[model samples]
Target chain A: MTGHIYIIGMGPGYKEMMTDEAYQAMKNADVIVGYTVYIDLVKEHFPDKEFFTTPMRQEVERCKACYDFAKDGKIVAFICSGDAGVYGMAAPMYELLPEYESQNITADDITVIPGVTAAISGAAQLGAPINHDFCVISLSDLLTPWETIERRLIAAIQGDFAIAIYNPSSKKRHDYLEKACQIMLDAGTDKNRACGYVENIGREGTKTVVCTLEELKNAQVNMFTTVFVGNSKSEIIQGKLVTKRGYEI
Target chain B: MTGHIYIIGMGPGYKEMMTDEAYQAMKNADVIVGYTVYIDLVKEHFPDKEFFTTPMRQEVERCKACYDFAKDGKIVAFICSGDAGVYGMAAPMYELLPEYESQNITADDITVIPGVTAAISGAAQLGAPINHDFCVISLSDLLTPWETIERRLIAAIQGDFAIAIYNPSSKKRHDYLEKACQIMLDAGTDKNRACGYVENIGREGTKTVVCTLEELKNAQVNMFTTVFVGNSKSEIIQGKLVTKRGYEI
Candidate 1:
């Protein structure tokens, strides 16, 4: 019988923000597995527990190690930042686990504890950009086709939805944010919308900028940045950004 | 001179999950104000401080009170669950403050700290339903026109963006989710997309369900629930919900 595999979200950086349940869950684990960055994040909590750290893009092997250890009745945990389910390691591990189970390995007990993500953290930095309805899309086409991303951008603008843009740009793929804003402009008026960019959320050197859609075209953005574009109701008042709920004041 | 008001997001109901800086900032405040529920959430930490609580709908007044108190050069902190900038109390307060300041009652200083929101918490509970690019929308049209909400839904689906739906329905508006689902179906194949509904994300009595877009329409849902609709690459695998990042396995 496999002991449980607990995939926990450490949440954006700081441990104090971690839930008691998540902290206790991680503390009770026999072996903890995660990316080196995440392992470094919670290493102080479990100085004596076995630690397994993998390089970036090697989540498959890291998860297999966790599942294999858990199969032998070890309490194993795979950790990720800001909710394991949001562009983190949990789903990929879950997807690959079933294939390993056919090799006479049992895979059953698995629980995912939620954590905060960058978009919310970024939204918290900016004032209520997501107060109403919103959408989040990654501008990176590393795994997703650009064409598909373009379609989503066009649709989001047409819907007049507040949008959280993730993986906006990288060294390999520059101009994704510019293109996204261009698409939004094509769908609607550039002056009527509000946009915000939050970079290095929850970490030192974090910076946030609130501007218009046209301003986003020239904003310095990167993978660490999460961008928000407001709907028709979003506004900038006295340098404070707001997306009105359209309620009677 | 008016002391500043720091509106902080405590993240999803966990002290350990609260950012170190946000925790320190709150600890240094002279006065803290929030809804009774949020005050209760962080009660143990500020047992000796001056704290005030209000009913849910009284956010505007509560914020005003905080601002008034802060004008005495006292550091006042307003606490919000998840990120203060989301559907929390920050925006309404920001909107109301400038008007008060114009009357020569100088507005208190305001600084917003980001915290994790329910969408990430919901995603964490459901196992990576928001891994790819996604969008978040609130179904409540209390402040927004239903027509605007409808347009956003259609755009999100057309973009094939995974969407997080907040405030799905309330007492008076029970048909919002149904109508939103109908709009999604109209834009994409109901059978092709995956959706997850998570309720009471950080609190007890949390429930999560993963199903096809068609099944989501029939799922027992409510205003407390946060719904995630997967993009084209999203799928329900062996009861575990996932959205592919398109990276090589």
Candidate 2:
């Protein structure tokens, strides 16, 4: 009997931040599969359940192994931080299913449960930086070409859309975030436009800083930080970043 | 003494879809305030609690009343569907606070709680349509200029970013969705590109339909419907919309 594969988002590694549906899905799974970091977040909640994890850059292998576990009659839950559907593990699960069809893995064998994404969660901590229209871009060039990412960044900046940036920097890609800020600056975004960045969102050691576009270009950021650059209407009020809805005030 | 104001997102109106923080915020409130529809979603869950609701287009009036309740020593929970900080109540709450300063209302009087937004919730049901870079644009032109919204739409389409459209149609605006589709098609988006729409998401009578970009222009849509248009890398696999990450596949 082929068991089901559940794709669940753990929502920033906090039990209080996760939806009840996500929590119940984890409890019902006979086994769990995820990246080593995300798996560690839920390990205490399900201490006795079986776990299989892979490090970064091993997403394809992790997805294939999840299908194998489900095919062997184990109800498997695959986890991702933030929403599984957003820059997370859900698409890979569907993208690789054709290769595992011969093992009796079918469309009915999978379910995708949504969770609060970092863009939304981080915006909340910054006090409504995403109050109006916005776009999200990741600066990581591990899989996608930098040229393509640059074009999207330029378009979002030029359009004056509030932009949320994910995977801004890493040890190897130290200057990508700086290049992105330069693009925005060159696009005529006001130097005083509000910007906010949050590190370790919804977890211990979480830190937030609200500044201006010019200041953010020099602010300390890393892969764990989710950065928000507000639009033309954004302002700093009472130490918080607030993007007013585009309307007559 | 002024009490606190909690700007909370109810997360698509289902108990199972809400986070523990949102649920606790509601339970701890002295009274709840929202649009009539969102207030009704949580009414049964908190039958003994007081609720204050206003009709549509009375947002300014609603925000004023919430502050009044909070200033009068009542712990007020201002509710919004989806994330309060995302096109919901959080911004207006801040925008109106300056006017209520004489009433003892201050920035420190409020807190914003994040919840799963419609883009993430609807994408999960459609099978990962926002797996990569994406933008969200609301089709309603009540406050924002139509010119600004159109420019953003064109930019997103030209950038090959997946787009989620909120408030796609209303009784007075029937042809806006068609006009938006024309913009995408004119920008060289393939007519066969995958598109999906959901009505009353995360609530009773939820209905979803997946189709091509050409077909979506004529699809039945309403104010409550959330529409998704895939990027260049999006495809329909096994009758579900799947947007592959920008990697060599």
Candidate 3:
């Protein structure tokens, strides 16, 4: 009586960028559940699959709805824009296991199919800024406290790890990325360290900009943008950001 | 005339796991370059295409050979095991650009195509262990000093980020992973924290093991294994390791 619930990453919104594992999971799903935007991305590929969507900020509700569908013996595919494990639906789905256990649902019924994440996809467009040890932190204060985010930025800078900032800016929070960049500068990081941002990666209207930390502090960004801040060894070689692995020549 | 040199990630060593973007790049290339093991992964698919591989320690010489192919006005595809941006060929290719530029080569001739990295792909098989902020560090001290690696591990532990350890062990570095676990234990981290390792992801002989940190300290690992160590908030729920993302009711 157990049904499958696959958590799939759509991978930056291009069909070509998706892995066959994710594509096959969705293609075989009896029902599809996701945010409104993500559901639209794969609608064309599975025209006959039952689809359900919820708007932004309704993650818990959407995940619950997907669980109910799976509990009823229908194979479900839950979609996320990037890799489902990274700041995506995988955590939320795991958090909901206790609520659905009464319906005989269990974590064993779920599977996560990984895909290309924004940090790697965006880094590819801007050149290679994440060649060594790196850390990823979301700049949004919606779930995590601002103080925690600030401390992580300072620690990452001090540790000299290349950083990939997710949810860098949104409508209500305009100055968070600026404040984060300031923390790096205050940590004695070079103002000219390679910094770049990519918007709408692998989708239409995809735009990318590469600059210094000084310039990125005031650059225009939105929720769609993912930022990359290079480490001390990162440099611009032939007009592209590249961080060497320190291999002895 | 300058020809294209595409830096591609083969994505965990399976045709089904690779993105269409990377596949097409290699399919259209006049010559392909990679390490011997990775080159063998796609050799059957491209029997007609010319391929060149270098043994383990000759990365520089291998990259030089790739540049030579592209500089001679032939399209070349340089393959990396995981995403090219993460501890892959993108940085080395960029570093070699100067040496190739003396042959009238330039950065404009190169393009990076991203794919699923080991951290993400490996996490998928083990459940959602990287559902929050995380850092990735390679334990191998071949290129990077062990002292620097130790410092980053401590910082990542203190920051409470989920950690992905790449190149966890090799022939000469058998005890490196054990040493890293001891640092986490000394930092007062829970000795029973959930940890797991995945080997040969998406290919033959794929194996995964999940256990507590204390067990991981003595676990057998090799260069092909990618390790995941959970943070303070991660736990085992229904036999799956999951890091909850503070969802509000």
Candidate 4:
């Protein structure tokens, strides 16, 4: 019997925030595979299910194991923290799906389940910082070049779209977010542009700070943080970040 | 006794796609309020809960009614399709929240539950076309001017980001999607760029079509259709639209 591979992103790493569809997929799977950190988040809920994990930088191997398990007649649930379609395992998994065709595994044997991404979950935490047209860009220059990142940041600012930044900073790329802000400022964006950041989204110790574009440049953020920069119409109304939708009130 | 307002975006109007938190909020609400079309989608599931609905273009009055209900000590669930933070009621609700201060309602009295937005949901149906940095833009020129929309389209293309288009066309603006494609071409995007569109996402009669940027320009899509134009790294792998994550497999 050829089993199925279910690629699911359980939003913010919380059970409550997970969609019923994702939860059902989790329950239906014979085994779950994910990064070690994400696997730890769901361990308690599915204690008996076999779990296969890999650390950071082992995504290729992790996805391969998922296919191997599913090909061996075991239903597999491959998990990521946010929506897999956005900076998650969905694309990578699809990129590798072709190699397993001889084993009778086809695209039909795979299902990608979407979840609330950090931008949406973080936006809810910040009282809707992305209430208008927005762009989500990652500051991590791992696969994508720094030049491409710079161009996207500049274009987002020029479009006057609210921005959600992922992987804003790391140990080596600690100043990338700062550099991004400087580039936007040089592109004529306002220094006082409304911005906010949420750390540990949908988890314990989740923290949010709303600030101006100037303050965000100097703010210290880690990999767990999701950053938001509001559009020109955005404002901090009554202590909540919101962008008006042009409703005649 | 003061009550609370739960603002939730249940993606694609499907019960399964709703997060556990959103489902719980719906179960706990004393009454539910939304636009008539959206309210009809949930009415069958929560037959016992009171529902208040207004027609389209009455968003202002509809939100005001939610505040009135909440102020009158009834827990209210204000529903929208997809993530509320994305062009939904979250921003408008926060904008109107201040007017009820004398009634003792504050920001703390509201909770916005995020869901998988159409961009993410539609991307899943298309096999992960948005695997890289992406910008979400709406074609409707109701609130935003057409000139601004054109500029954003150009910027998105120039930045080389995959594009997820929302509200692509309406009866009044049927040619907006076509216009957007032309603008991207003028901005130096390839006419053969991989693009896909999904209609009635997560609902019955859901349909998806994969085409090029040129083909997308002539495709017939309505408000329910979410269009995705892949980035430069995107390709069709075994009949699936996928963007590579630069994995060395």
Q: Top model by lDDT, which number?
A: 4
Q: Is candidate 1 or 3 superior in DockQ?
A: 3
Error of 3 at A162 (Å): 0.6
Decreasing TM-score order of the candidates: 4, 2, 3, 1
TM-score of chain A of each: 0.91, 0.97, 0.97, 0.98
Those runs of model 4 whose alpha carbons end farther than 4 Å from true positions after fitting are none
Which pairs of residues have clashing backbones in candidate 4? none
Candidate 3 lDDT tens digits, B82-189 = 899999888988887887777778878889999999999998888888988999999989899888898888888878889999999998999999999999899888
Error of 4 at B205 (Å): 0.8
A24-124, model 2: which lDDT tens digit per residue?
A: 99899988999999999999999998999999888888888888888789998999999999998888888887887787778788989889899998988
**What would the per-residue lDDT of candidate 4 be over residues A28-47, giving only the tens digit for each residue?**
89999999998899999998
Q: Model 4 chain A: which ten-residue window has the lowest total lDDT? A: A240-249
* Stretches of candidate 1 exceeding 4 Å from the true structure: A1-3, A16-27, A40-49, A102-108, B11-30, B40-49, B100-108
For residues B21-48, could you state the per-residue lDDT of candidate 4 as single tens digits? 9988988999999988888888898989
lDDT of 1 by residue, A1-249 (tens): 557888887767767656555677889998888999888978988889999898977777887887788768888888887777777777777687677676544324777776667767777667677776677777877677889888888877777767778888899878888888888888765754788888887777889888988898889898789898887778876665677665445
Off by over 4 Å in 2: A247-249, B102-104, B247-249
For DockQ, candidate 1 versus 4, the one ahead is 4
- List model 3 lDDT by residue over A89-180, tens digit each: 88878877888788788777999988999999998988898989999999988888888888788878877899999999988999888998
Candidate 3: residue B157 Cα off by (Å): 1.1
TM-score of chain B of 1: 0.90
